[model samples]
Target chain A: MNTTIRILRYGDYDAMQKAGSNIPATNSSNHATSTAPEWPLWEVFVRSKQGLDHKHVGSLHAADAAMAIENARDVYTRRQEGVSIWVVESKYIHASNPDEADSFYEPASDKVYRHPTFYDLPEAIKHM
Target chain B: MSYQPTVSQLIHLADNALILGHRLSEWCGHGPALEQDIALSNIALDYVGAARNWYQLAANQINSLQDKAAFPLNAQGEATEDTLAYLRDAFDFKNFLLLELPNGDWAVTTLRLLLSASYQQLLLQQLSTNEHADVAAIAAKSLKEVTYHVRWSEDWVKRLGDGTDESHQRLQAAYHELWPYIGEFWENKLALPIDIASMQAQWLAKINQVFEASHLPQGVLPTWHQTGGTEGIHTEHLGYILAEMQFLQRAYPNAEW
Candidate 1:
């Protein structure tokens, strides 16, 4: 027996490059000699309280994961807005390609049968 | 010991917290990284919060003892927390000299905080068990905050000490520069639950643990340790700190936010 796994890639880097986007090249060496280059960006998620799902708050730059979480706490949770925090490297986060948005997501809008709202239910079934 | 700490002793403790908090706040927007900038500022806020508690307690203590001949009154004939913080001169401040030293570099700041936080952790731990109810309560509250401060500084100490040759050297230099002031923290004669010898031993053990983990040298404390901060003697740095911190209050007396 053989097993198969599906892998999806997001953000067309080649197309983005061809379009001459403003995104900085990954390994540029044209920085000033006096100061070190900025650290990588991290996306921050915060859970406002226990039993709540983590929601995307904002992003910050940090040297590493540990620093990223700490930075998230300082920047996002300082106002007691979060009881928990999550940080992901912006580089590691594969965002959906904006150029392919219509092809990828537009078809789902036409699939009206997938909605549970179409089901005929008794008058007492309020939640369904 | 059935000893009760004097209002002066409480004032001294408050002074230490306020001065250190002010120093840490200096790095609010100037931290090497944005994360670090926030972290340091958060720590500064905690210090200020703790100081407010102590100063309030001290002020209450002073007010209660106002009828006593030993208590002295200010020009306005009151000893409020604000008066203690803003109206006091350099010679009257009881903070340790270690805290007043300028924020030299990241390494120096981290090491200094590590040392101060370790001592404060032990001090507050002992105070939390004090016979006095108010002292015990304040210490109990501060202990929670100081515990994180210790961990944060300890992590930075380890990171900088074992990070690289340049970082290691910078940390070592910080340790040397800060070692002398460590003695002043221990020399306080306050009538608290703290055993100077025991606190010293515990502080040294904690420092040694970090040093071992950081692969830094140990047993470098000077034979002749600097003292006199508790006696109201301080370095020139305290003058500058007070000048900036107390400026608004001094300029606009009785000004309310």
Candidate 2:
């Protein structure tokens, strides 16, 4: 009777606790207290300099866009990991739904020209 | 090799690092990020270690002032915990004014850390090869750590200062608030608290280049209303700090874990 399933959108989850190994805490709610309830998870990307693509760094807590930027700089750039940063809220992100994955990504499999396999390569077009 | 450092001088020497380190540690786990928390804490630990060395040295002087014979430092007979415990108390510390202020923000801490590392690197580099083995050993180890801390601070200072409007504002504010304290580093008797006029100038020259690269304005002396920290005077914050830090050591004299 239940043949269908529900799938969550992108940025639905985050890896929050990479905290130190077994560091004792007198209060269990310290981390939770600081993190906002609707505080969107942010995906971090670090670019070492200008005109560069941002590589995924790590996640951190932030209330808004401004705080997000500041938090990213403090967390990822301490080692000068990036000259620029990109923070997209986890909730704002829209990834290909898992239920739609087959239709979304696998449709390209039938399009051979997209893979460059169908193109007839002349001897002069060596690299292509 | 050994050197002659007065008990008062040794206390101040350790005071600079201990107090600054103590202030920096307040950012622990509360830094804008986890990595920053770890990095700042590491620097704090380094200063704490350095302070312990100087305290041990200072304690030796206390031993010498006694009427007892052949007593080890921190082990003088007829000496209550009050003697050594006093040094651990914040009220007794003589750190420079530059170290006692609030940490401001990431940009400010970066600026302060950068300034500290540059001064520390140069001073410690010279000290590592000095005639005093204890000082030299501490300097040698500290120099390695300060080198990276300086690089990290310098790099971020440039990025945050030149970035978008918000970051620029954060950095500029941090700069103005912190710039006044820069002069304390160049003054001979504040930090080194000794004769080092030449070294101060040399450090300034090296530091000037990095500050320029960060696009920060040149350093200036503190405002007329604010310049007592170098000479044993302190802000009201210093006492609170002493109360917390010395609590354990004072409450239980000679207690070592």
Candidate 3:
């Protein structure tokens, strides 16, 4: 039941291999003994008291999820803006490549028919 | 009958909160991490807020009594929270010895908070049902804040105690240092609203449970129990705390923000 969390840098394959492939460090504060590794970054989302969904507040560093939530509470909810919080490890979030934006999204920009604006409206469609 | 006991009880509670809040506030910008730094400050503010409430109540109680000759007063000739807090010397303060001790490290601070918050939770719960309306209301309001303090400290104690060998050792060391002073919480020198001794068993049980969860040692007793902080006899540490905390007020008498 070792609780020592290890952070692996993506490019440091040699060090990762040397440390035995993502296992928990045998000792807590292992980072302290060597070069100090920063705590993992967690993206914080806060549902404001009046909001229906959690909104991205900001990111903070924390050792784990529980710590992340507490950190988020302290950092994001200091003004009582939040009714709830959600935290996800920053590394887990995936985003579309900005470099491929033209090929990925430009094709839909001129396609007016895709927006349903070209369709004729019914006479009884009052809400629309 | 003199309202001496009620005033003393209120002052004792206020002193504990003020001293410990000041201690926690010392970690404002210097915590191990940014998030934790803000967290500690938030908790410190809570304690200070509670201290103000208790001090105001104490001041009111003292003013209601006949012995106005000894207490400090403002221009309007009424005792105030500021006067009680800033004017009193270390010998007049009745805070627990455990609180006035230096915040050694993150482990020590969190562990101490856990222990004190647990005791306060129980004490406040009992006081919330007290005969006095003011006492009950203050206790009820303070209890909510102390509950979160307990949770935050408990989580840290578990993490530090169970996380690494070094962390565990540090926590163990803090436990050894702080254990002796815990006896003063149950000391019955004051005519408090409730039986202080009666809360000891529950407090111990809670401590033992947390210790077990944290992978810390349980059943280890201190060689000797420290006492007398409740009776105005304090450790040398309190004088320094007062000197720093009351410096502005003491230097500039009747200073107003």
Candidate 4:
């Protein structure tokens, strides 16, 4: 589901949009890439309620993760919202190889009996 | 000793929370920085919220069960002397020495905020984990607020305690005037008329940490202000404070905005 991603950019949006296909170079940073670098990246999470795990909420520009969580809480959870939270610097995360996605999990598709739905009995338990 | 809280026992808790909240709210418009102003006022509001919660808690715990809402005077239109007698009973509240003392200066107010928030934070944490469900819920919610309050006040206290010569002198003076009241915050439950006795030893360590970091000689521990704030007794200041706080509520019965 692709929604419109609107952002107020610093430089000439037309030049950036006309010249490139994906995100403009400046969205990644403010200054000329050759000059001083961008602000640190941060990852945000929201714990909807008690006993639930922290789900990846989103990310936005932040100088640090501590400030990021505070900003996220203000921006994301301004309403009476989640009870707990956790945040980490985006750059600190190591990614799993996307090339390995099919190789890693595709083998499990053949094991249909592994699913509990095959032998469902009680009407109360049908949803399982 | 077995737990037993008299009528005044509960009133003491309610009173302390009430007066301190009043004193803190006075700082709403006046603060060192805009950021701090926002932060302090938020803390002030939290105190008021805590005070109201404690008052209601006390009201619930009070032994009198006969027509609590039945009293028409509480809403409006009171008796001449008869109403005054009833008002006397309610106002006869006791609170901590730290809360009752004059908010002497920014230094003193900040100091009081720092120390009081620390102790309150500790107490709230203990209560949040306590066996009593009501106390625990109130404490859990209030603790987060007090933690931030303590953080905000701690920054100010440290800055003042170690800053300019004038600032240091004023800060010390604030402490000296207010130190006597510190005992009230840490007093054992004996005549405290409140159940804070469990925390005397605990709070002392936290206070000592703040003192040690401030690195100032305790010239002389101010003689404790042994009186004021218990047994329905109060300083000259409380009546004025209550008049201001309760004025709108008293005037407008059943009014909600």
Error of 2 at B184 (Å): 2.8
User: How do all models score by TM-score?
Assistant: 0.83, 0.60, 0.84, 0.58
- Model 1, span B1-257: residue lDDT tens: 66577877888889889989999999987877667888999999999999998988888877777473344345677677787888888988878889999988888899999999999999999999988888999999999888988888898899888887877888889988888888787666664557888988889999999999988888555677877777788898899999999899889877788
Q: Which number leads on DockQ?
A: 3
lDDT scores for all predictions? 0.83, 0.68, 0.86, 0.62
Model 2, docking class: incorrect
List model 3 lDDT by residue over A2-43, tens digit each: 786556567666777787776444453432322124688999
- Give the best candidate by lDDT: 3
Worst 10 residues of 3 chain B by lDDT: B1-10
DockQ for each model: 0.27, 0.08, 0.32, 0.03
Residue clash pairs of candidate 1:
none
Q: What docking tier does model 4 reach?
A: incorrect
Q: Which ten residues in a row have the lowest lDDT in candidate 1 chain B?
A: B66-75
Fnat by candidate, in order: 0.52, 0.10, 0.57, 0.00
- Candidate 4 has a TM-score of 0.58
In order, the B-chain TM-scores come to: 0.94, 0.81, 0.95, 0.78
Q: Per-residue lDDT for B224 in model 2?
A: 49
Worst 10 residues of 4 chain B by lDDT: B77-86
TM-score of chain B of 1: 0.94
Give the higher-TM-score candidate: 2 or 4. Answer: 2
Q: List the residue pairs that clash in candidate 2.
A: B90-B242
Off by over 4 Å in 3: A1-37, A105-128, B1-5, B195-198, B220-223
